[model samples]
Target: MKTGIAHLPLHGGKAPSWLFQRMKRLAREITIAVVSEYGPQEMLRRLSDPFWFQAFGCVLGFDWHSSGVTTTTCGALKEGMKGLEVELGLFIAGGKGGTSRKTPSEIIRAGGHLSCDPEKLVYASRMSAKVDSSAVQDGYQLYHHAFIFTKSGDWAVVQQGMNDASKYARRYHWLGSRVANFVVEPHQAICCDSRGDTLNMVAVASEEARQSAVILSQLKPGVLVGEIKKIQHLHLPSRHHVDIRDIHPDRLYKIFVKTYEQAPENFESLLGMEGVGPKTIRALALISEIVYGKSPSFHDPVRYSFAHGGKDGHPYPVDREVYDRTIEIFRNALRQAKVGNNEKVDA
Candidate 1:
């Protein structure tokens, strides 16, 4: 699978309903074809591929270069999979905004029906979200998460985060089979147009810093808070992006108490502790840099790419006649092949 971080412009509004309906049908048909020929795990592999996923969004008739492609295409797939998930042995949960938060419950519900371990899947879903948001702070706040899994427990994730300052979005892909370690360079590769200031604690080079962070967090709350207060008085490099609010002693003490009690064995465990967000991680990383002389990677992990335009007509408006004809051809082929859902797809 081709893997890389992707950058795209933010398109306003939603996909037109007429286009979305056809997208739903065509999306479902293509999914059925993939699952029948390659099985659900291979389908997961494909979804975990950024190139294939972007092409999929294009084929679904969404704006290929916009961030909407991720959310809208995922929405199309999830909407299309509605009735066939059980039969197809594939389940897609979570979506943009509020739907993203419901991923755990949805995973449990699917697992209850399928008999595979739900907790593992839930952990995968939650950790993937947490890693991209906190472990790798690349100026994007994640607002969309789509988790796709098979009945056999194979899984993949396609989540997007947006940088409001730049009006650009970054996409992250995860194939459970590809990720052996969540904290150390989980992505197969990191590519972007430009490297901005980012706190990439997940980078292998940050191993020492991560260890120091864990050790520092285990310090008594009072002692840790005292150290943080001292850092506030020192002048950190501007690129470090430290904020007074991030290391406020009162709040830091509370968070320190939790980590101190937990005594996390590793950085991954410390990261998963409750209330450990970007701010807390950032402060710890800065402290590690100042005191331990081990700074986290500040390289942004994103790549730039261009694709076909959208319904709004950047390059050209979507050709409805051709799009419809393509769907019809696939539906007819599936129908002739006697697939159970061919008739529904043809509709």
Candidate 2:
């Protein structure tokens, strides 16, 4: 599956239709091969690994550096498994843009065939998105999310966010086996071209700040706004990560009222509050640091290959004959292979 990953186009979104059909068939066969050899859980493990996932897109004939790799690869995978989910015992839900928003409903639809509870899967999907977009503010707004899960309840997330100013895409990865908390240092890896100052409320060092924000949420709306204004006119220290985003007093008061009535018990709950978002989270973190003197961590949480190992390419379009031939070879091999070999059948 080695490829010319270095010559990939960074922004070339989606493979053409004729190629995508072949991609889906190849993706499906690959999944079958992996699941046949190592089992569904192992398949989940591979998808969660950033290196392997990127390599998978490359083998499927996608440009390595393209931001669309995240969305397009996930799309191919989801489409590939259409009616064989129960037989394969693996499932993929969610995709780019509005498709990402339909993840919960899709998971629920697949619930009837799963042994694991669907609600838990739905919550993990939402919390992962929440943490990346709001809890860890790296200035990239998430537009693509892919959730991969097995019948046993294990799951993994592949999500990407777009930075309008820098025009760069950052990807986040999560493995359920590695996560003990949805809101605290939960990502297994994040991939980006370069590191930048990020307001990371989910960092371990930000624990005190998180606690302080929850406690502050209990205050009256007017009282909270009063504390917020003290820092409104002041500039935040460069070394410090606490700073508010663009927010108006009236809007803040409304969110304050909701949190006041609900009284979130912890940082995760505070983040899950209906009206809470990146701006509001920044405001809370800012207030916690300035008014309450508890600073959140300014650490960026990316851990892996620098920018997914993709170099600029010279438009070397994929050869259809070779691509189609590759698919047929795999299709034939899988058709002839005995899926559950060396068990009762072999004996």
Winning model by lDDT: 1
For each candidate in turn, the TM-score is: 0.92, 0.90
Candidate 1, 1-347: lDDT as tens digits: 11567788776799999889878988998998788767998889888888888888888878878899999999999999898999999999999999999999999888756767889999889889899999988889999999999887888999999999999888888899877888988868655556667788888788999999998888888887777788888887776754655457787778888998989999989988889998788878877887889988776655412233457774677777877887887767777667455554444
For each candidate, the alpha-carbon lDDT, in order, equals 0.83, 0.77
TM-score of model 1 vs. true structure: 0.92
lDDT of 2 by residue, 273-340 (tens): 87899878888888887777898888887652222122233135666677777777666666666653
List ranges where model 1 is wrong by over 4 Å: 238-246, 303-309, 338-347
- Candidate 1 accuracy as lDDT: 0.83
Query: How displaced is residue 219 in candidate 1, in Å?
Result: 0.8
Candidate 2: stretches off by over 4 Å = 1-13, 241-245, 304-315, 339-347
Between which residue pairs do clashes occur in model 1? 191-302, 191-303, 192-302, 192-303
